[model samples]
Target: MTQTHIGVDISKDMLDIFDPRCGHRRIANTTAGIRRWLCGIGTDSFLVFEATSRCDKHLVAGAAAAKIPFVRINPLHGWHFAQSLNLPKTDRIDARMLARFGAERYPEPTLPADPARSDLAALSQRRDQLKRMETQEKNRLQDTSLAILQRDLRASLKALAVRITRIDALIRDHLRAHPQLAGQAKLLRSIPGIGPVTAVEMLAHLPQLGTVDRRSIASLGGLAPKARESGKFKGKRVLGPGRRHVRRCLYMAALAALRHPHLFGNAAARMRVAGKPGKVIVIAIARKIITIANAVLRDQTPFATA
Candidate 1:
């Protein structure tokens, strides 16, 4: 049986729908419209949306509620599809391309969130936002020297810190409530430089540890080291796109580990003795830490110090 595919192009305030039979319909990107559109849609009907600069939480939530299989493709996917056809760009055109892409090519199906995990994720994000605001506000201290303003800024920072602490507590409570996730987080923390924050990210982002192939995991977490080569020349090693957040956390962890003699320095020194540059050795250490993190998560084992 053939399944129908519906593609939706979502913007900040508008949603354009395109199907082969029905050319196109522009609708408000609202919950009511979404639910109305989703009525009677089969699981086989591919629902596709592009991830924008900000999260498409509504779309993800709607798909989850509708029990429709959906994917958030990179916005670039839509643009490339447009370019391939040499078509002029418009919301309608993008929507049509998306519908075609959904019907023919589908990206990964988004995993629906459980309420508990959803809350934990939200709490974590709120704390991050608070921290970001706090950092920006703190940087503003240089401008004003009035004791009142300085005192207010200090108080605001303190309050933000408390709120962030509260959010962390919420996350921790939720993680504790969910034994499985908490256990995985614990294993992640067993790694030398992976603190609670890094461990939480590993658990949240890299949940299906053993299932993802090694290279895929590395690439997914933005940790995969790539070699650069040209005709008649081999260039350098570089890291490419993956899960940037996880990769960054691991990179920071690697930096910390690099400071300790036994963890990274000794190994790096050995590599340097064999002619590897310090920067290259540092990157190698980062990769090694990623490998260890993956292994620990996959096996549910404590990290073994090298």
Candidate 2:
């Protein structure tokens, strides 16, 4: 069966839609508008949209509820494709380009995860935001010489710290309430270097940890090194793009793992003996950690030191 291709350009207050069969139209970016748009499409229709922060949440929720197939393309990927077509920079043009790309590329549609996972993901993102805010305020405080400004910045930092603590407690409570997630967290934390923060981040961000193969898991975490080479010239292998939060958490875990002799320390020692650079060794360790974690989750077992 042929599927209808739809492209959507989402903004804060508006949604620009391009349907190959019906042409372009703009609508209010609201739940009602999204439901109205979904009502016009068939169940097999393939809707494509670029990731627009929180702007696409309503559309995604609506589409998921309506049982319509949809794929969220990366904005960077969409922009590069648009440039290849020499398309003018406009909402309508972008939407049309996205529709064409979806039709031609036939990317797999995303399936919605459990609603509880969504809540945990939101809480993880909020924790990251609070940390960033706290860091910025601390930096500003360092630069300011005025006593009054310093006091205000310190107060803001304290408030942010308290909020972060509260969110941390909330995340822990949520995980504890969900038995499966709590068990997974326990398995993850059983590793030598994996802590509560890293375990929660993995649970929240990487829902496919156990379901996917090793290569796919590494690629998703951006730990899989990509080889760069032409016909004759060979270049170094570099890590590709992936979930930044997951990668960051894994990298930190790798650092901590280096302190343990039995788990990651032995691996790092071998790499160091082989003359691998510090950063390179860390990346390798991160990849190893993720691969091991994936296997543990897949087998429904805790980490084993042997």
Candidate 3:
């Protein structure tokens, strides 16, 4: 039997669906609506949709429950794909474009989400928010001379710090409750520079760290350098866009690892001796950190310094 390619354009309130057999249509972006729609699709149907925050939760859950394979693509990627085809922009057109994109590309199905990892992700985001607020408050406190404003800023910083501490505790408790995640965290932390915060961030944000190849893991973490070359002239290699938060975490980890000689220090020293710039050296070390972390996690072994 031929496979069915179904495209779904998800928004906050509705889902625009395109079935090759039935053309374009709309449905409520709710559990019941998603269930009913899934019930109507054939077993061989494949779903293609953009990753629109939590808006596609019901659709993902419904499709997974029905044992349907689905691919959640980046919205920007979908847009670029549409642009390539000179397709007009609209919910219906997007749904059609997605169906065509899926039929042509046959992208791999997304893996089911882990609830524990999802919870950790939420906590990670919350902790990051609190830290950012704390920084702003601290800056404001420094800029103000009024005692009243300074006191308010100090109080805000204190409350933010408390919230961050609670989030960290929650992350610890969560990791302990999930043995697999905890073991992964332990493996990640075995690397010289990776600490508790970095390890949790990796576990939450880059869940595919261990499962993918070194090049892919680096690319996912935004550490992979993209080359620029045309004819006889070659431009400087640049870091491309990727998971911003993961890259930030790895950058901090790299800085910490520079303090030790056996881990990333020697490598950084060699690069520095070779005339590499400071930022370049740091990024290179960060790349090394993530790759080593990936290897240890893949092998389920603690990193041992050579």
**Which candidate number maximizes lDDT?**
2
The TM-score of predicted model 1 comes to: 0.84
Taken over the whole model, the C-alpha lDDT of each candidate is 0.75, 0.92, 0.91
- Which lDDT value does model 3 have at 297? 89
- As a whole number from 0 to 100, the lDDT of residue 64 in candidate 2 is 88
Of the two candidates 1 and 2, the one with more favorable TM-score, higher being better, is: 2
What is the C-alpha lDDT profile of model 2 across 1-306, one tens digit per residue? Answer: 899889999999999999988899999999998999789778868899998788898999999899998999888999999989988999998889999999999998887878888899999999999999999999999999999999999999999999999999999899988989889999999887799989989999899999999999999999999999999989999899989999999999999999987878888999999999999999999999999999999999988887
In angstroms, how far off is 193's CA in candidate 2?
A: 1.4
**What's the candidate order when arranged by decreasing lDDT?**
2, 3, 1
> Can you tell me which runs of candidate 2 are displaced by over 4 Å?
141-150
Model 2 TM-score?
A: 0.94
Model 3 per-residue lDDT tens digits across residues 124-197: 99999888888888888999999999888888888888888998899889988999999999998889889999
Between candidates 1 and 2, which one is better according to lDDT? 2
Please give, for residues 1-306, the per-residue lDDT of candidate 1 as tens digits: 666677887888878878676678877777877777777456667677787854466667777887888777877767888788898877887887888887777467766766765566566667667878989879977788999999999899899899888888888898989987788788877777778887776666555565566777777777777889889899866787666667767777877778877877788889988998766776677777767777776776888775
Which one is best on TM-score? 3
lDDT minimum window of 10 residues, candidate 1: 203-212
Model 1 misplaced stretches (Cα beyond 4 Å):
1-3, 53-55, 103-106, 142-149, 226-237, 259-263, 274-280
